[model samples]
Target: MTQQTQEPTTAELSAGYAAGLDPREVAETILTRIAAREPVLNAFYLHDPAQVRTDAAASAARWAAGTQRSAYDGVPVTVKENIPRAGHPVPSGTAIANPPVAATNAPVTDRLLEAGMVILGSTTMPDWGMLSSGVSSLHGVSRNAWDPSLTTGGSSAGAGAAAAAGYGPLHVGTDIGGSIRLPGTWAGLATLKPSAGLVPLHAPYLGRVAGPLTRTIADSAALMSIISRPDARDYSTRPYPQMDWNKRLSSPRGLRVGLQLDAGSGAPVDPEVAAAVQLAAELFAAAGATVVPVAPFMSAAMLTGIDAFWRTRSWADYRALDEAAQASVLPYIARWCSAGKDSDGAATIENYQRFAQLQQVTRQATESLDLVLSPVAPMAAFGAEHPMPSNDPDEPMSHISFTLPYNMSGQPAATVNCGFTTDGRTIGLQVAGRTGADEDVLAACAWFEGVRGDAAPDWSLVP
Candidate 1:
């Protein structure tokens, strides 16, 4: 079989099984790819070949017996390091030694396993999922597949790199502040940040959900179908019974898509980036969707307030650690903690107040629209070693202006590769929908993907 045909997607793998491709062979091919490319990308945090082989063998038997588990049977997938898997260490990408192993699989992990998917390993993230760039103290850095000098945006860093590099067809990553979408955009992949509680998150918190990063939207929808189910452990999880996410993809005719170029932050967007987003809007228009340009709804105060709230949480977690452990953290993370250490209870309350204001503005701006589209990040991928594109001390949150608002308002958002820069960097278009409109957000993304054909960069050309 050709190399391209060897790495089948979730649906392709299932169909290939019936056509006489053994699950064990597919599993071995994935393992071999991981071994060859992982060193360059730093994608896997903990990959066990033996365990993956065992799981593949079991899936093979099940297929042979006509008792296949689910549509993802034998499909290889990687989970983020912060996500727990039974007996695997949940490091959260830190320098702490001997991190405790999880006693049980996280709800998402359990659901994927139940569907007969092969767990390739855990992917790396920034320390405690704090940074947009994937420069972690524990596992080093995850390089972008298109350009290694540029970052694979984090905290879902490794998953993005793995997806772009074709390590596998499906990768799970969590997003709080553009983690999944940022990486997805930088690496030229499709990713989703589902509506809050649509995908059950253990230890519920604001602005966080586990979602998939894949080369194709159908694979993402397939993974969503399995992981979006209600888990009793996550009290905030909403019931998602019998939802066929894959079938939701259709021509987006008559969909009112509002295009916002800036988030009112005055952050300069790259000219190429702006053009790519406009081109995406044009694509939607051609697909029979009305593309309307809308004013930026997010303000400076709103962005700063959201940054402060998350930084405060990071500060609290940092303070709970021993002094030496805190010192061992990445300097950027340390600075993040130190900056928010002075925040009082009133500051947190004020942050929430600002959140409410932003939520209201978002609702008002998107009220008459079916979906809102924008650039995923203000620019293409930047230096892998730096925290942000700029070196200015006060500009840490500038890049995330487009993505953070959705996290605050609990809206479902997704990012798809729209086009490429002159130098070959990928550009992403963000599609966000109403609070409970997760399916619509994904459908719009699927439609965009269909119009764009396949935009993924040639990973084999990357050094």
Candidate 2:
């Protein structure tokens, strides 16, 4: 019967497993879902049915003997392709032939395996993990589970699609400039872009963090509890602090919440998206939280400067590749990175300084507010084939204004489906808190999810 259930949550799976359900049955359910949906979603880069079956059989034996490794010992999970998983090729969304295989697992991968979770293999992403749409150089396009014509936002593209399609209970995604949250929004899933350094990463960078994407906030929290474990490999990680991430949710009463509808520099928020976000703010106000408007912390120069810096960084990597490999990159990414070749040293340094400026302004803007609410993306899902909403390489980052600030500020942010667009695409309400406030942000998201009722689309109906 577990195999017959639709879109089961972690809690549901855990209870089922505890009640003598075979881990293989749950794994069979997941694999069946993947088989039916993957042809349309293109959500995974590497999936081996044999490996899945082998792992599930082992976990089934453990559960039968009452020797499960942990509460989630048999739970199915998927990691984004960029996360190293020893022997797996981390192509990082590029089309390089024979891409380098990871010599060792990423810290998050190690933690997940050590806890006895069954990894479902790596999901797909955009070329070089640069774009916010699902179109990729190597993996083709990953479409939304809600509608194949619409994009599953990226570069956590496939993770979002997989989570929404009920691939499993847990999916690991990396976010820097809204990769995780944007995909979470478009795919109608719960996602957390943890504070920088909160989750140990194999190669940490400014504004980069590994987090979870799932259909429910509690599942995201549960997965976070596992992946956030400290690892010495990440020198940039903060002191490991243990917390019951899946602990009881807290009331938001007396909390000062800021509602930011205007992103300041990106394309204007769609009327429907704006309305959905405003309604979310009103719900918070009604919940005994003081809701106030927060002035936009982003500027045109800041966004453009950061974009330039990223381009330069991308170009640096691209230029190092052989001409054949460079030519294999997505044309849009190739064009975007080529623009970076025009920047001089002085300009590049000046552009990089915008990071500090962004961090300072963001902190100052929300210093008095306990949390900030905004639209995860300015609009709902766009065409699945485009690299961005604009489809313009020169204006690549216009959609990231809302989600990028938190990454620069090193703050915790999350997205939960608030409402739907006129066309029925999902709208995401972003909940962000200052640095070290990840728990608070996640808790608020959990509370909001409770109040939001059952707005998620039924996966069984997807074509």
Candidate 3:
């Protein structure tokens, strides 16, 4: 066929192959898009056009030989910088000179490669995945696709930006606390943070998990099925029953949904954000689901406790660095790390106790509901270079009010674009399910996509 000029979804690319479109040609189109947009978005860290062409050519040969590896065999995909890829340095978005190239691929990377997906490149992230904005001392800032002046939420910053800008149909991101969903919300994309242990972690932490960010919930589900496979290297990965997530999309007719408008942290929520979430709840009701408004069960004290635990964990990482290397980190991250450096065993125990209390409260609140809906972030995308919208210490943590608690509870949570603000900022609706109900969470997201329509930002207007 004629050379393609526009971005195609993962499903569209697969169908094109059946209609005589060459995978190599599709790769060429994607590479061209990356070249044109990378300067504006700064989404990628290490992309090799020649290497991608080589992989795409192999995929074309497989298709011609009727030996395709998977439905997404020829589709382009991007991985977050923190996720290891063989021969690429795991910079974790730092300025360390001559970082060692990874000798092995992360489990999620390996799964994508085995599925015959063409790797577009690795996306940028915050140093040590510590911040909520895209700016990193090593990679600069990853700009929001809708408005470059605004920040792309972190630590999955580049992943969200890339997906929103139509760099590819699928991208993978890691989240300890709202990293994936936050950016997904700000960029007007779909993202999933599966329950802990559902997706294997390269380096295990209390609530860290790797998941997909895509233009649509269907694309996210397709990638999720592949990456969620068991990996021997990650012993924390639990055995998951095989199922077709693509088929799980249906009307949430009888589902019980709880609407939480405010996170109860006294953090201000933009009117547009609240309206978008309420719209989602209204849509669920219109679709015959039972919807009820619920007060935030998570308290400010519980959030502070969780934040302390995260800071302590970040402090451990910072302390492992040499004095000279420590000086290379971003000021905010350094400050964050130092805040917990003096934390003692007593503080750790207290944080854990508070965490348990939050978990217990969350369990009771969500015990009778199929899903809970809230705004992914209290506000939309803010300044691209700032760590947070406000200088107040509590403001940064408060922004994650709706998201961090689920991380503590180890429940599956996702975000989908609901609507855009009056000034053009994107808004997202968060949908979360009980622990071990990742598929259910995904299904709810898909249902919302059906109601809202999976319309991503028009990247052609960018730049």
Q: Which candidate is the best by lDDT?
A: 2
Screening candidate 1 with a backbone cut-off below 3 angstroms (N, C-alpha, C), the clashing residue pairs are none
For model 2 the local lDDT of residue 386 reads 91
For residue 171, what is the lDDT in candidate 1? Answer: 95
lDDT of 3 by residue, 1-463 (tens): 1232356777888899877789999888778877877797899988899999999999999999988899788889999998999888998988866677899899999999999999999999988887888989799889987778999899998998888777879999999879999998898888999987888777877778999999888888888888988887887777667756876657888989999997877477999899888888998999889998878887888877877877887888888889878888877778876778677999988987877787678778888999999999889889998876664443338788888778778888999889888888889889999888888888888877766753345445544
Error of 1 at 122 (Å): 0.4
**Models sorted by TM-score, best on top:** 2, 1, 3
lDDT of 2 by residue, 14-126 (tens): 88888998889889878988998788899999999899999999998999999988888889999999999999899999888999999999999999988888999899999
lDDT of 2: 0.89
Q: Which ten residues in a row have the lowest lDDT in candidate 2?
A: 1-10
Off by over 4 Å in 1: 1-6, 240-242, 248-250, 391-394, 453-463
> Each model's TM-score?
0.95, 0.97, 0.94
Q: How many backbone clashes does candidate 1 have?
A: 0
Clashes of each: 0, 0, 0
